[model samples]
Target: MEAHGPHADDDLVTMLTRTGERVPHPDFDRYAEDLDAATLRRMWHDMTVVRGFDNEATSLQRQGELGLWVQSLGQEAAQIGSGHALNGNDFVFPSYREHGVALTRGVDLPEILRIFRGLQHGAWDPEAHRFHLYTLVIGAHSLHATGYAMAMDRDGLVGTGDPARDGAVVCYFGDGATSQGDVNEAMVFAAVHDAPVVFFVQNNQFAISEPVTRQSRVPLAQRGAGFGIPAVRVDGNDVVACYAVTRWALERARSGGGPVLIEAFTYRMGAHTTSDDPTRYRTRADESYWAERDPIARLDAYLSSLGELGDDAREAVAAEVKELGRRTRETVRSWEVPAVASMFEHVYAEPHATVDAERAWFERYERSFAEQGVHA
Candidate 1:
């Protein structure tokens, strides 16, 4: 399945309306129908908790507890929904702003915090959580995902008829990442080889300061068509839609349907990172417009309509989010920085002489900062 131009017959208008207007239609209903009361509640809880974690991390960066922070304040549903759609065996390759996805994939929050706090390259083993380390090199992870899918295919990890073993790889990236050569290359490989992977693009409508329209002449999904991947656009802020579409694609891949591309229409509510100020590039009206169609708020409306959300539930979730924030702040504050010598440990399995010598010199230089009369 490769990318193609949007078809007049493919319901693009309906998909866009579902995402932008929050309309209730057959496609939206089909996706929403699977959300049981318990699952809906859980989704709400997870979103609230992750949002709290996001805000606290941003604050920590500002307060000097973290070197930097990537806020996912507005993209929680896009991440969390897709994450929850994965089976345990599915592999996830993520870009840096996927804290919600990492949380859903069971990566310890504190460990993810450790990376930004400058304590480790990454805190969790990728294999352990089926979640790769956060890739900061823009679209590079898409290549890794393509390779992983190829390996899975070679290993006969598809069409086993056993859903658990027949897992696919999912790589998450942003609208900006689509412009990268690595991403394009990955798409080419995935489509040509028919690898079992899903390219989940969270098109938050801006790449730093560039609007999404500037990045693509057509819709992003159409980009996949040229590469021979079946593509779909979904309401990223609608958790139900995100989960349903992702699950559908994953099931297809696992069952030997090859690759698919999903463009999650979303918005980035905060700065690109703590160091950025979106106000300098984007207008307040743009922010306000997206904020009104917030994923959480939309979910809240759906839940309320179903009689699943109430004052008690709302207050309880809010309190839990606050507690999550408090715990994250406390945990981050308590973590000890790694020893200066530990930096050389993971460079390679065997010690390299040059690295050892460099480490020794670094230790000496570090100790000088603690020595008396070192004010200069």
Candidate 2:
């Protein structure tokens, strides 16, 4: 389905336009009005910084610095806007490719690169950052988020009218994951318990090479309706729309409104990962079509029109992004991988006979490699 202006019948909410226009919305516009110049500028910075680092990471993967890389190239607005809407205390669960969300949460570059570089099972502590480890197992994180939110509810911490104490959970995933039983089960559990969770699905038009049509007869946003969750579709390319919609959803969940689902209508501009080839599965025409709706360009246009992003400001932001990219590249290159034996050390929280036996066998196998003069 094609994206359109915010309307109840169309079910697509568009507050910002690709041509640097602002869609008329009496309610949603309040969120934009409350945004100061500095905040808008920061959003612009966040998008550029994420884009710059994303490009650098992709390059590093091509250069063999990483085993695989997933680019958040075109979906920056969807991720960044929603990411920024969360408070520091609100927990976030991510799929493997939510680099933009990690950046928004103030995670360091090397910590994010460590997993793709095959160094760590989890680089950052979820309890510390309120951003959980990247859940590479597709839809598993949704269940995790729902469970956490349910705990928050049981603790009576969600609707306390306190910013620092009241917290909601945001779960990020792609359109394809919605088809998984885990995601559906999560939605059911969340709705049934009135869990303080917002399901943010970035419908990037593809689940690998398969189009979204093959995954659902209706739009993915409507999937929540079957489970009694309120869902809204947003123009994912428009950062303002994404932020406003996510803010509304999260606030609703925090205030005992139950789980809300937001389908961020977006397009993936690159391959599914460094190992995949977009040209083999997608068309050049599709790229051209989404190119015109580039989120960064749209924000730049609005900023430029308002004299907030003059040439000097643009140059300044560009320089900062370049430095960020450089630092990210350098830090990732300098990261040291843990020793192979260290993996076995953390296999169990407490020692177990089976784990000890496996570790002993693994050590024996490694020692044999040295004795046999093997290249392992």
Candidate 3:
């Protein structure tokens, strides 16, 4: 598949160029006009920190400290920008690779690694953070998010005119997930019910080894329009555009507008996961093309031009990034194996004869290891 860089399309909503130049948008520029140098600097810090965290996770996976890792490497701007636009009460349902979104939601970085380290089913409280546990099943959470949005609407959360009480839902999934039946069904239900939801599709150009071209002949943004929902495509590498577009979509959803779809045109820039090999299916030339539009670098350049990110600010951010990597490494290494019996504890609300018997057998099997002077 031929690579389509951000500059190739004029229709893409954008506020920043590949070379980090700030540009104006007729419709969307007003949304970002309120963003001063301070806000932009904060955004730069966020994107830089998350990218550092993502890189640390990748390294951990390679070092065998983590069983697996999914990177948000090149797509940091799409996540961090949209994440910053969310209201505190708004809920987010994310796929497994949404580490940047997790960071923005105040989820403890180490807690996110617990699942990948095989220590727990889920480590954080979804209610506390308003960020649901990462869904590993492809496209399943789209239905979950839609159902939640319907519930929110029924509970008088929609069109309330009260910003504090009104809220919307954000459902994030990858380009590959667009092909799933569940995603289509979710969109259908969301549109029919006029649910207050924003379907955030990060179109990272590839679904693992399969190119998006093989999946659809038309732009993915049209899928939302087909369901009678408003849709917009943004240059996913442009942080300002992402923030503006997401804010617009969320406002519509919160104030009685139905479901909206945002197709973030971006690239993955790495393997789909630690288990996949991009080198097998994609060429290095394609990787290099996206690298020029690297979101963090682009934002850095823009911030530098405005004199918002100088040597001092860069040094501070670097220190923070270094500390984050150190903390993550320490935390992952210090994790102790949870008791084996803990798994059986949450299998059911009430004790069952079958579960009891299985637990008893497992305990006996575990004791067998102790008898043989081996760790179970």
Q: Across residues 33-81, which tens digit of lDDT does each residue of candidate 3 receive?
A: 7789998888899999988998999999999999999899999999999
Question: 147 in model 2: Cα distance from truth in Å?
Answer: 0.5
Indicate whether candidate 1 or candidate 3 has the larger TM-score. Answer: 3
Return the number of clashes found in candidate 1. Answer: 11
Candidate 2 lDDT, tens digit per residue, 4-66? Answer: 322122656887788987777766777666677678788988888888888989999999999
Task: Note each model's CA RMSD in angstroms.
Answer: 4.1, 2.5, 2.2
Better of 2 and 3 by lDDT: 3
Per-candidate clashes, comma-separated:
11, 0, 0
- Tell me the whole-model lDDT of each prediction, alpha carbons only: 0.83, 0.86, 0.91
Off by over 4 Å in 3: 1-8, 348-357, 364-376
Ranking by lDDT: 3, 2, 1
For model 2, what is the error of residue 285's alpha carbon versus the real structure, in angstroms, after optimal superposition?
Answer: 1.8
Candidate 1 vs candidate 2: the TM-score winner is 2
Which candidate number would show the highest lDDT if scored against the true structure? 3
- Candidate 3 TM-score, C-alpha based: 0.94
Q: What's model 3's overall lDDT? A: 0.91
Q: Is candidate 2 or candidate 3 better by TM-score?
A: 3
